[model samples]
Target: MTRIRISSGSRFEEEIGYSRAVIDGDHVWVSGTTGYDYAAMTIAEDVVAQARQTFENIAAALAQAGCSLDDVVRVLFIVPRREDWEPCWPVVKQYLGNARPASTLIHAGLQTDAMRIEIEVTARRPA
Candidate 1:
């Protein structure tokens, strides 16, 4: 199997030495994506907005891997505040409703208070 890497051009990728996503054969594995917009280098204060941006970031990485949300087979969501999860559900549904991937959510400390959410996904090209 051949391996390919996708970079989102985020400074962290260089500093931490990690790709945004990796494609190995037909499988795509995306890193934990935060709400910070790589181009804008900004994050929204509202949790819902952050959630939406998180998915957008993930989507971009998936596109680079020649996959889409529909290809996702598993998802993981991390939020510092449990209450914030409900507000982000609609945004999550808008992007992932069709995929209906197996998912898990956890409440935990994040790197910064500004970051409200982080998402990670694994996808496989349909056979």
Candidate 2:
């Protein structure tokens, strides 16, 4: 198997030495993506908006690997506070509403002060 790195100008990736996503044949592993806009590099204040941005970022990575949310077999989400979980859930539901891949949520710390959530997804494309 060969590894292909996928990057989309996420500063952390450049500074931390990891690709936004990695493709190994039919398997695509998208790194955890925050809500920060890649272009503006800004994070939204509202939890719902932030969650949407995070999903969009993850979608972008999956698209690079020749797949979409439909191809995602799993999703992992992290939030800073327990109270934010409910607010974020609808956002995840909105984007991956029908796809309904196996998902998990964790309440913990984030990388930056402005960031409140992080998302990582694994997807498979037919060979």
lDDT of each: 0.91, 0.86
lDDT of 2 by residue, 6-104 (tens): 998977888989999999988899988888889998889888888898888888888888889888888898888788888777777788876888999
Worst 10 residues of 2 by lDDT: 89-98
Clashes of 2: 0
lDDT of 1 at 60: 94
Predicted candidate 1, C-alpha RMSD:
0.9
- Across 7-122, the per-residue lDDT of candidate 1 in tens digits comes to 99999999999999999989999999999989989999999988888889999999888889999999999999989999988998999999999999999988898998899999
TM-score of each: 0.96, 0.93
Point to the candidate with the largest TM-score. Answer: 1
lDDT of 1: 0.91
Segments in model 1 whose C-alpha atoms lie over 4 Å from true places: none
Candidate 2, after superposition: displacement of residue 100 in Å? Answer: 1.1
Superposed by TM-score, candidate 2 places the C-alpha of residue 20 at a distance from the truth, in angstroms, of: 0.7
List clash counts for every candidate, in order: 0, 0
